[model samples]
Target: MDGLHAPASLALGIVPRKAPALDIASIPRFWFDNDPFKTRFFDALSLLFPEGEKFFIACVRDYRANITDPELQQQVKDFIYQEGQHGALHTAFNDRLKAQGVQVDRILAKQRTIMFDGFRGKLPKRYTLGQTAAAEHITAIMAHRFTHSDVFASAHPVARALFAWHAVEEIEHKAVAFDVLRTVAKGNWLIRAGSMLQVSVTFPLHVVLLMNHLLKLDGVLPNPQVWKDGRRWLLGAEGLLRPMLRDYLDYYRFGFHPNNHGNLAKIQRWREEFAEHGDARLATDRTLHG
Candidate 1:
């Protein structure tokens, strides 16, 4: 593969200097309108463990300093915008939990101090690029899972909408990270191999910990009913994993292309949903009886 042909992974398009606008109000409402269980799940997880957002912000900040391509820089900026919106929305959700008497500030504080403070210095450009590539690949698979599974089907309409919307964006920018990595670190098979391995290990670990934390916070950690419901929701989702990892592994096999396998039609569908019901209320009447 000609290294020059490697499209900028961070490039959203050929457009230059476009600032990313986030619909923040559209975010927390989606979370609130989603399934009560899932909302509680995400809320508890976000409040107790805020490291994911810190990691995302750190990666984006690193890319800002490291990526040279103008178009790629814009895409990275868009990504940072989306991630920042997610963090802000989740923080609000965490606040709601605290208002309801959930003590999560200490947990989040510890994570912020440990993770964000630890990564304050500049990172190696190549390693940063590789990490971004790996993260994008993992998020792409998660987007697919969100779309394909019934995990969010019975969720509150707005919650389902939020996850669906986030998934579509993930699909939209899925190639940016890989494109950037290939552009800056071409011919480095070791970096590619190492990224793939790290992704394989970390994705599952993160999910497991998130789930465990949620269960513990909900007082369902020892409940067999919770396991049964969770098992049913997760059983068929394994199929989403292999294809993503396959793509990650095969990234170097041919010319790296951005228009690879993204679901544009699905993205359009999400746009329609957003236009139709984006005005939904931030609070829902749903209860977590399930």
Candidate 2:
């Protein structure tokens, strides 16, 4: 970590940057090597963010006033800003998907029904925050991979920038929900572990079902080659899931924190790259890192 960013992390936790204005207008439907499976996999995730992030903000907001730590309070404000923009930008991204004849509306309706009507606001505040924290862990793990790895090496420039930028911010406030849970839940391990267990089962199930929904739309579900390649991408050697398996399991460790990943230096480098290159950050940073 550089001199400037080290203290910020220790003192204020992760500092969320101002939300960038990303224009995904020219990004195509199958933006990654024209692969519908890959495209829909991400599209499914993106579709969840708008209302989903709003629920995250709400989860944090419920316990915000009770937080006495000034640092955590500031982090809460930044978390809202970062996640709000994420929801907005993803709404736009989903709009683009709709323009390309993707059945985003159907997917979103299903998500709202399940997330809101089925789950949100129905649980106790602590449990809700626990769920939020669990989901944040998942996103942070994914954010680290997306920004720090070559998983999206062949993705469209716009699409890659969108995820990379979102990834950095996700890393930045990755602990806010968890921290809030610790403060409010009084470090209840059962609640935390139980939440993770529930999230572990439910999240992947949703993603798989949504991915199937998306693939069916493109008539790609019947293509055996698509599943073969997707299986490799998800579970094969050098797969995204395979490398991050330990990181995912680390959540169940007795006393895990999001920063345990030790990727802050990479986050700083990306932040500097964004500062120096503006909209061209991804390309420039790739050249620098390479």
Question: For this target, which candidate reaches the highest lDDT against the unseen true structure?
Answer: 2
Expressed as tens digits, the lDDT of each residue in 193-246 for candidate 2 is 998899889888888887887788777777888889998987888776775677
Q: What is the C-alpha lDDT profile of model 1 across 90-166, one tens digit per residue?
A: 56546655654556676666556644564334445566556656666666655654564344545555445444555
Total backbone clashes of model 2? 0
lDDT (CA) per prediction: 0.52, 0.77
lDDT score of model 2? Answer: 0.77
The lowest-lDDT stretch of 10 consecutive residues in candidate 1 is: 281-290
- The collision pairs in model 1 are 9-176, 9-179, 9-180, 34-156, 34-159, 35-156
Candidate with top TM-score is 2
TM-score of 2: 0.89
RMSD to true structure for each model, in Å: 7.4, 3.7
In model 2, residue pairs whose N, Cα or C atoms come closer than 3 Å (at least 3 residues apart or on different chains), thus clashing, are none
